[model samples]
Target: IGGGSTHAWCQVYLPGAGWVEFDPTNGIIGNRDLIRVAVARDPNQAIPLSGTYAGSPDDDLGMKVQVNVICEAVAGDSMGASAS
Candidate 1:
């Protein structure tokens, strides 16, 4: 697993490929263009030391994100996963 302030993702080693990344956070699959910094057993280990620093003793914070999935059919391919 790996993570950064901008993105976090995990990878599995394949026979032919060193590591295939899968972004559980955003559900994105393999790609070399993806920004990656480190890898570990889990995401927390990839964060920089400063990432855990709090602004102040009394500071509080919350975060929220939204994701959407859009699918479409190609000229010669089936649209859904089960299609053949």
Candidate 2:
């Protein structure tokens, strides 16, 4: 984890591919343009915020998030399965 007043999240793993990044922080997933600092032994260790503040604490923090998943038809991908 790094130092800041921020938030972030990760993605589930695929069979062939390794862990891809999914930002619950910014509602973005597998965005190659975004930067990934580091990963950890466990997901809990990868928070974007973890530090102390020296100044007087008087400010408030609030955040909002949204995610959208769309599925479209693709060639060569089977939909139905045959049962014996």
Candidate 3:
């Protein structure tokens, strides 16, 4: 909500804990139901085919996204969020 991109996530490293990811935007405390494409030391690091906008200070930009999550039917599985 501050600038550039709309979402962000980070991981932390503890001595014996290795690396753990946390997504503050979705209140997700772990890497469950997520994918790790690439890791960066700095959030500003450039991603392949990624770009930035150069616009007037007063100009506004916007985007909209829709997400639909479906769970696969696994044997003896009935523990998760159900879409309604």
Q: Ten-residue segment with the worst summed lDDT in candidate 1? A: 62-71
- Candidate 2 structure quality by residue, lDDT tens digits, 5-78: 25455677977987877766566668554545556767567765555656556764544434354666678766
Best model number under TM-score: 3
lDDT of 3 by residue, 1-84 (tens): 432345568887867988888777666776875554456877666353456889998897766544566658787877684877
lDDT (CA) per prediction: 0.63, 0.58, 0.65
- Residue 52 in candidate 1, Cα distance off native in Å: 6.6
Report model 1's TM-score to 2 decimal places.
0.37
Residue 60 CA displacement from its true place in model 2, Å: 12
Tell me the spans in candidate 3 whose CA falls farther than 4 Å from its real position.
1-6, 14-16, 46-49, 52-84
Candidate 2 residue 5 C-alpha distance from true site, Å: 7.5
lDDT of 3 at 9: 80
lDDT of 3: 0.65
Clashes by residue pair, model 3: none
Q: Model 2, 49: alpha-carbon shift in Å?
A: 8.1
The clash count for each model shown is 0, 0, 0
Candidate 2 lands at a TM-score of 0.37
